[model samples]
Target: MTAAKKAQGPVLTTRALNRATLERQLLLRRHTMKPADAVAHLLGLQAQNVKPPYYALAARLDGFEPEEFSALMASRELVRIVTMRSTIHTHTADDALALRGLVQPARTRELNMFRKGLAGVDLDQLVVRAKELVEERPRTLKEIREALLERWPDADPQALGIAARCSLPLVQVTPRGLWRQSGQVSLTTLTHWLGRDDGQEAVPDETVLRYLAAFGPASVKDFQTWAGLTRMREVFERLRPGLLTFRDEHGVELFDLPDAPRPDADTPAPARLLPEFDNLLLSHADRTRVVPPEYKGRTWLGNFAWSVFLVDGFLAGVWKLAEDKESSTITFETFGKLTKAQRTELDAEAVRLLEGPLGTGLPYDIRYEKVVGA
Candidate 1:
């Protein structure tokens, strides 16, 4: 049977959806939530690299200091582990332990893509040896690879090392994930980081339910896509009676918690500077709500991708900051003609951003130039 389609209440124009997303993602304005709280509320932050999220948070959270997040890792309240879509994400320690088991299947599939390099290598035995090597003490990436070569001498040791790290519930140690610093990859057991004996247990449905609680009123596909799990349609069906469903105009189903913020389509949104690869941009399948169609080619740049200006919620244009020894100037180039007043407001926001948060310390000089024939 086709799912129920409630009458469209207010057609949230693309701009309206963009604003709502910015508000929810904390990009519309800097907020005061602690790093751990912020990570928990957003489910997790995209942490492909460590420093990016620190800067990303700094841009969004008021008075955000790097140590605020670094301390969480030190306290074992938060952990840097492989979770959520089998990508590197920084999540609460409790969530890390609970969700690791749930996403293992996805991890295994991803790990296999590099398996040709591990041909004739025994993976089951490798995990045992890999765990033994790290259990005694943390080891740097090179050290781990050298030790693994003892068991699989002919195998590509680097590939072997990466596979073992992902297969096992290993957490990348800090200084590795520290803010404003660069460090070598190091391996330590997740159990060691969290200081818990229950690391081996299978995560239960409550963990999946927690994802639903935050990003819900969503379909099983959305859940699996975000969490990087599979064979979970049954899970969504099981949870169906407890969720609220609505079909978008395209007939694709969307699910969310009944009480979650599906705010009015007309809610006012402000200009935002989003970090590259912000969760707000990467979290969805349908991006029409935030990125304009014509600007897609520019947003998905060929070589140089800069942080974007989300004006009135949707991405309006691209902005870049460049500096010589004496001064820094922000340049704005829009896809279409801007009214004189709009151009003025954009220039003001750019000045505030470079000086206010980035603290470039150089003088602020802003300029606007239209794309010829645009």
Candidate 2:
């Protein structure tokens, strides 16, 4: 008889999948990794709105200084560009490039939304002019629009600006995204920012590898959802030779790196405060892995605006901040029961988020009240 083949453990349940995701995302606990490394692991930070992920990393790492991330941006180790979902994000220079290649379909979809506004416009002509407008000097959306107006005065300036936003390969000029300071918005083409010709080929396989490396143990649907792109079946098939996968109890397929860490489902996840739009919370299609179903509607709010929250590796409930002139207070309103100790733990975590991670320098009035009162 042939020797019995070594057996892997039983297939992970959705809960198990959720747990693995939380662990990889640092939702299980704040980690000691640098912001750049964390950004790489989670694939990239969602930076459409700034200030959130800086707090996200501060909560995750020990003594995380804001300047480290700013330096990364300045040095071009990382870049703030409109890429994934055709929205602004702060990503590693390489991830930005790869995502640019991966998200073409999604960008195309967004471009269609502006078709009426950009009717009869020559996209190729726009690209050449747009590139010239920002090659050496970074210009604001208004400035770029004004320049375009001289050539295409018949077009709506706002529409032309929005068209450039969707069709042209642009990046926010630096100092706009620098840490600890706020500046005016300006645009520069991707090629000029990265100092390389933009390669427009589809790199679905490479994109898949990067996704699994950072936010893996996830399903193809999760990847598709995260990338905002469809038609990834071929990419997954081609990458099968290098990936390991399992089926959830629901039988949805999940994929991950062979060597990626899978902590036990019961790993002791500490209370964590996440920044709005943290990648961990948004990387999956089924967010049940990190966010509990009860509070999903409250936190997500259907629009781009996001709220901070508390979790013990699993989604506990929604959190929000209300600030006054005297102090900044964070209220933890839970959808589930919390022991006295858990409440205390959550309060301390909240204080740290405000005083340290958020660097608000304002005293905090933190509290955890039952969701429905009393």
Candidate 3:
């Protein structure tokens, strides 16, 4: 049904919202598309750490091999950069450029958060010197901070580093993101890394459309939360006529692309493992559409976010992996009871995760532990 027509339709249940988002995120089924294509489809993967994108893609793509994704990074086809919400993410090169431009306003807001630390430093000169240093050679944040200290000895070193990151479109260099390859996080401008002479600015209208396509049937608050920008209601209002609109169970208006997928609520959703800080858990304001209320506030402990997995398409539990010379063990700590069938399905999925995506030759075991506070 057209988005306009759907406006007058029955209210969408939580399960219906869950299934539709899973379908768009490629979590409903593993797709055979190339990693780059998948990255584009989902906008990009939340890649604050090196391994999440690998794990994220492995869960969504059929027959995914880490080397295929690694090759994209090695060849500069895919890039790791700080974009949405000023968090590092892995994006296709084209998206790295376009999205960096689109989210510049958010990055500016991020800089404002550190303004007290940046006192007494010339922000304009800081961007110039930092850019020159990074473009000359990809420098670690430490290296950049120490160098900046030479010019602004009294300014907060950490803030200088953050200001440099916020002001410039810095991309985390390759070896840092390459699968199984470990390296320090280093930086260079997107222009320097991609060798593009064209303007990096993106049209805001196109950005809004892309957001809806990936995470939509969503509200203006959801978009603002995901993008870390404010006053986006005006943007959504301007695009309202051409877009589809629907009220969630709470009567929040959701806007979506007319042709985007919205699957039946009863569609079967498989159990799947997800890495820490996965976008599925972080991208929406009304996360009730994906995360159960009982599981809320449980995934994070202090500053570390635990990896989680889905059972019946909702956040079921936290997971941890321990590997030895002989075998790899995946431990699921559940918040509630699971049926025999659910346990069996999770076991089978865990086996596939170890042997298929992780490429571990060692024997594996899946074990369950009682939730700590349950």
List ranges where model 3 is wrong by over 4 Å: 1-9
User: What TM-score does each of the candidates earn?
Assistant: 0.82, 0.87, 0.95
| Higher-scoring candidate on TM-score, 2 or 3 | 3
In order, candidate lDDTs are 0.69, 0.74, 0.87
Q: Against the hidden true structure, what lDDT does model 1 obtain?
A: 0.69
User: In model 1, which range of ten residues has the least summed lDDT?
Assistant: 1-10
- Across residues 34-105, which tens digit of lDDT does each residue of candidate 1 receive? 888888777778777765577567657887767778878767787778777666788788667767877788
TM-score of 3: 0.95
lDDT of 3: 0.87
- Candidate 1: segments with Cα more than 4 A from true spot: 1-20, 28-30, 198-217, 300-305, 319-353, 356-374
Which whole-number lDDT from 0 to 100 does residue 46 have in model 3?
93
In model 1, state the lDDT of residue 229. 74
The alpha-carbon lDDT assigned to residue 307 of candidate 3 equals 89
